[model samples]
Target: MTRILFLFIDGVGLGPDSPENPLSTLDLPSFRALAGRQPWTSRSETIDRPDHVFRPIDATLGLEGLPQSGTGQATLLTGENAARIHGRHFGPYPPTTVRPTVQDKSVFAQLAPLIGTDRLAFANAYPERFFQHVEARGRWTVTTLAARSAGVRLRREADVRDGIAIPADLTGRTWQRLFDADAEPISEAEAARRLVALLDDHTFVLHEYYLTDKAGHSQDPARAASVLESLDRLFAGVLEAAGPDDVLLITSDHGNIEDLGTKSHTRHPVPLVAWGAGADAFSSCRSLLDVTPTIVELLTR
Candidate 1:
């Protein structure tokens, strides 16, 4: 079976060759191996490789202002120009205007007919507090809203306890320290195994890693370095465990942490990396709006 492990590393972009950029600061072996070199900075960026595909899609979708998580993520997941629809870049959370688009066009929604609802997995687990917040505030991230709209079960605390789901962080550090949840911190290898395990039951698996975006907003060099290193370690483990049939696809909505010069998102192009039998199927995508369509075509074909 051709299963996909969609690793959505938030707030990353093809950054420039600057000291503040993690690409210039950290040693990322997994990324290096995939690209056959280090991640390209704007001073030295490339596109269209056999194993890796780096495309600079317009996050803004021709709307003005810096790209944001709400619109950018909605566009990435649903193939809709969310920012343009809203007439402005809108947030950490998606705006109400584009909520319908996300619900309708997310990959989860589009692939439901072909893959079946039972076989698509939103592999990230939420803490009790998160559930409580959503219940009270009626708020949801673009990814969560997309999955829920498609009738997919969002992984919960029990999923984490059963070693079947990953926390927002690859390791369960925050879960162990911040919550009363019995989950303990695991090694990167364990995390990778849990992610790969989803392939047994799922045709499409989505795992969100928001620390990259968080690190970008934090503007702390040390934190940025730490997050990048940890992410690369997890990527290495997943790469080692993934089977030949498992297509590993990594991408982001917008660039932020890649260049810590500011505390906001950058207009730089996002990274779309896919490796497996149908890796080249994604090469034609020119905008963020093309991602879900490309994946839907490949998975259904």
Candidate 2:
């Protein structure tokens, strides 16, 4: 079986090969080597190697203004033109108009039947506050709602405590810092090991890191650098752990943190980076809308 580990790194976009871009500032050897010793540039979009493929896909969806997370992530997860359906780019949460698409066509819902729920997982864990917020406002991000509609069990604090799921930071450091618990930070190698073990049981596993988007909006250079630095370690561990059959798909919803110069999202093309056997599976994609369908097709096949 072709096991896939889908990595959704939020708020990343292709920018100029300049110091202003945090990605350019990140001294990540593993990621840099995957980029063929280049920055995340338009030139990198042309890159195609056996084990790595770096392609830039449009995030704007041909609409106006900066692409927002609600529509962008919805489009990526459902293969729907969410921006068009909402008549414009929507924000932090999905608008009422496009919520149905999120619930119905999300990759989680689409693949549940093909691969069985037992063989799939959404690897991010939610905190108690998130559940409380949902109860208070009855809203959620596109990914969470989609998984719920598909009957995919969303991981919780217990899952995190037991090491079955990871927090949004890719480590439990935030949990330790925030809750003042005795939790030690999860190492990148351990994260990679846990993810690989999940792949052993699941045909597909999805882990979302949304802090990139928050850091982009905060426009804090120090914060953005910290987030990128941590992710580089986790990514390096993932690269070291995953093997030939373990297809790795790393992508983003829209562009944000890449350019801290702007407090708003940019009209940049996000990268669709793939490794292992799955690299070729996304060769035809050029936009966020192409991601979910391609992933679903690969998993179902």
Candidate 3:
């Protein structure tokens, strides 16, 4: 069987203003369609389908203060309580001591050998400038470090230029350009469709969407709604195209986008939604650290 397709949405959570929450706004016909007539909420809920059921997994690690992306992601992908280990929540960037842990224990590093290179893929293609910047500065995030350590090819411009990979937006332009051109409006459904199309060849594909955090920082309800609408459209498309055997796992590192009262991460639990073969494996998870181990268990079993 093909490995799971992991979809990581940065800084998302379940919250009120039901209509305003991006998860709620998403007209995910595919998800709802698969989930049948069951109730869906930004908070944790389970949906049963003919083939399989998708359940929401939590992302909070149970520490005080706001969750930081670096530690939160480290915990999510490594199954380690990174914030607690470091004494407090770290940053958008990982601390020096945490580097080894991220490199050695992250999902990519732990699972790559079991799954093989061709079977594993990270879908976010990088621009040429990003490569150049990283080369000069030598700074890296937990995700990048994990992928690099695992020998997973960090997607590059060629992948995008050749159409092998699509931008986070379908138009094949930089996200900045998409924002500039109100003309480039592709709904969340469309975005998900494109992602599904892109996943045809890989056993494991990971895609990251970071717009929620940006919307939270801006604290504009209109902008937040717009972001949510876009994601809803994207997921709708993915659900429509998803294969019966394919698994879609939607998760996050922290809780920044759910609450707009402050431009900071929340201690509230982040939602983890899973569909397909190994969806049940997530039932064993309770914190961020359990995610990577759960995925590994599912795929390796």
* Model 1 residue 260 CA deviation in Å: 1.4
lDDT of 3 by residue, 1-301 (tens): 7457778888876565454454455554543543453323454455544335555555556666778888888888888788877888888877776778888888888787887767777777666666788779878877787788788888765665554554554444444463332233344555566567656776677887777788887777777766666666666767678886688888888776667777777666666667766576676666677788888887888
Query: Compared with the true structure, what per-residue lDDT tens digits does model 1 show for residues 54-94?
Result: 55555657877788888989999998899888889998889
- In model 3, residue pairs whose N, Cα or C atoms come closer than 3 Å (at least 3 residues apart or on different chains), thus clashing, are 26-232, 57-272, 79-289, 188-233, 188-234, 189-233, 189-234, 192-234
What lDDT does each candidate get? 0.84, 0.84, 0.69
Runs of candidate 1 with Cα error greater than 4 angstroms are 43-52
User: Model 1 Cα RMSD, Å?
Assistant: 1.5
Residue-wise lDDT of candidate 2 within 1-301, one digit each (tens)? 6888988999999887766688887776766765667766555646676667788999999998889999998999999999999999998899999999999899988898888988878888877777998979988888888889999889987887787888777888887777654545687778777777788788889998988899999999899988887877877888888877888888898888888888988888998888887578787888999989988888777
Q: Model 3, clash count?
A: 8
Candidate 3 lands at a TM-score of 0.85
Q: Tell me the deviation in Å of residue 89 in model 1.
A: 0.9
Worst 10 residues of 3 by lDDT: 178-187
TM-score of 1: 0.96
lDDT of 1 at 134: 98
